[model samples]
Target: MADELKRRLVHASGSGLVALYLLADYLAIGLTWQYFRYLMIVLSVGVIVLEILRLRVGLEWWLYEKLTREYEQDQFAGYGYYMLSMTAVVLVFRPEIALPAMLMLALGDPISGAVSDDSLKRVKGPKVLVTMFVVSAALAAPFLSHAPLAILAAALGATVADGVTIRIREFVVDDNLTIPIYAAVLAWLVLEFVPI
Candidate 1:
């Protein structure tokens, strides 16, 4: 029962934060306190760094290990940090469409990796990418009718960005630097041509 509780908490917190971010964004509450969100992001990163140090010192486990572990300790810590980081960016930057898409990437990717059990269970390459495209589209849909297209583009962009960064950082770089940047660029493009 303890294990069951842990699993439920991990899943709940992991998915819950993303859902909250979406809710806040759709309700337009995030934009009102955007700076607070960035502050939260900064705080979240500091926490991750501190935790990383703790894990290194044997007081706790590394964030990535916790994220990938079957147990909840690592996931709870990792997810808590992720939620803060994501909420921070969404609030500060107003990356409405990209907010959910990126969270989907952050939350969903690790979950997928964990759930894809067995050495023989190979997720098809294109199918996996396509699945992400669909998922991204669905998540981004409420923001606008063109949200799916934006998400598809972002997913591909994210894939390429992930490939480029895989060996670069020993710890997670701010998605403020990654996913939000993509969202910013997309938002910029969307805003660029409108008659002012």
Candidate 2:
């Protein structure tokens, strides 16, 4: 029971980062895109420095241990990937594509992660997919002109990305990074080709 509670807290805490992403999206409308790029760069550098200090000097030892995955103790944590991926999406894609994609990652991935088991025993589990689709679609509705189809495509892509775990040797790619990129690409394709 305690373990379950701890897990929920940790996952929920991670999900809280979504608020920051959403804030960025909101700010993007008013600020120049270049401002976002610079902000991301500063954030990335700050996170990297803090992470290095934490690992090397044992800074904020208790908080770090509590928040970090066991596998990430010796490596950069999910936060790094989150920032990197968010930056990539903002920089690589147009604002229209980037915002929905970030929203899919920010909202949908967390909903799926909180509820679903980590195992791939069930390929593209229904619960996670459905939750992701609903959350992504709802969050994306206001921003997107053709909300239904574009949001559906983004949701589907996010679900697939979240469901699959990619690894290169010892490094496991976090869903935070993959979900937005996949969703953005898929959403963009749908928006471009399909007359919705």
lDDT of each: 0.47, 0.71
User: Which portions of model 2 miss their true places by more than 4 Å?
Assistant: 1-30, 55-60, 120-124
Q: Give the alpha carbon lDDT tens digit for every residue of 6-67 in model 1.
A: 53345445455455554776877763345445645775777676666555654554434434
Error of 1 at 145 (Å): 2.3
What are the runs in model 1 whose C-alpha is more than 4 Å off? 1-12, 21-31, 35-39, 42-46, 61-88, 110-124, 146-148, 159-165, 169-196
Instruction: Estimate the TM-score of every prediction.
Output: 0.55, 0.77
Candidate 2, residue 70: Cα displacement in angstroms equals: 0.9
> How far is 162's C-alpha from truth in model 2 (Å)?
0.7
